[model samples]
Target: MSSTTQKHRNFVAEPMGEKPVTDLAGIADVLGKRLVSHGFDRAYIVLGQFLVLKKDKELFVGWLQDLIHCNVMQASNCWQCLNDWCSEFL
Candidate 1:
C-alpha cells in the first residue's frame, strides 16, 4: 500500500490544541502568515470557520480562495485536515 503524506500523518497524529495555523501541513509560510493576519492564528480557530461553513466543500474552497488565494489542492487538503480532525475529536 502506498504511504500517506507526512502532512496527513502528522496532522492526524494528535489533538490540535493551540497549534498555530502555520503548523498545519500543506499551508505554506506565506499563506499561514496571511491567515494569521486575518485572525486565524490558531488551528482551532480555523476549525471554527470550517465548522461555521458546515463542512460544505464548495463553500470552504471558495472561502479559502477568496481569503488566502489558496489553490484547489491546498484548500482541499486543509479542508480534509479539519474534517478529519473534527471526526476524530469534535
Candidate 2:
C-alpha cells in the first residue's frame, strides 16, 4: 500500500475538483481502474456513494471490501481519510 500521510494531507487540503478515483489514498492504479469500471470514476463519485450511505462507517468499509476487494487496512484508511475530508471540506 502507498503511504497515505502525504496523500491524505494533499487530498483534504484542497477542493476535490476533478480529481480521479486514484487520488484517494487507498485506491492505487488497479483499484482506481476497477472503481472507474464500476462507474465510480472520480473521488467525488465515491464520496457521493459514501454520502448516499449516510456516512455509515461500517457500511462504507464493507462496501469497499466487498465491491473492490479492499483489505482491512485499505478500507480503514479510506474510511478515515474520507471522514476527515468531510470534517474539513464538507
lDDT of 1 by residue, 2-79 (tens): 245687667867999888897675587999998998999998898888889999878988898899998998888888
Error of 2 at 80 (Å): 1.1
Best by lDDT: 2
On residues 1-90, what C-alpha lDDT tens digit does candidate 2 reach at each position? 235688877888888899998888788899888888899998999999889989888999999998888798877777777888898888
lDDT of 2 at 2: 39
Best by TM-score: 2
Candidate 1, run of 10 with poorest lDDT = 1-10
Give the TM-score (vs. native) of candidate 2.
0.91
Q: Which stretches of candidate 1 lie over 4 Å from their true place?
A: 1-4
Pairs that collide in candidate 1 are none
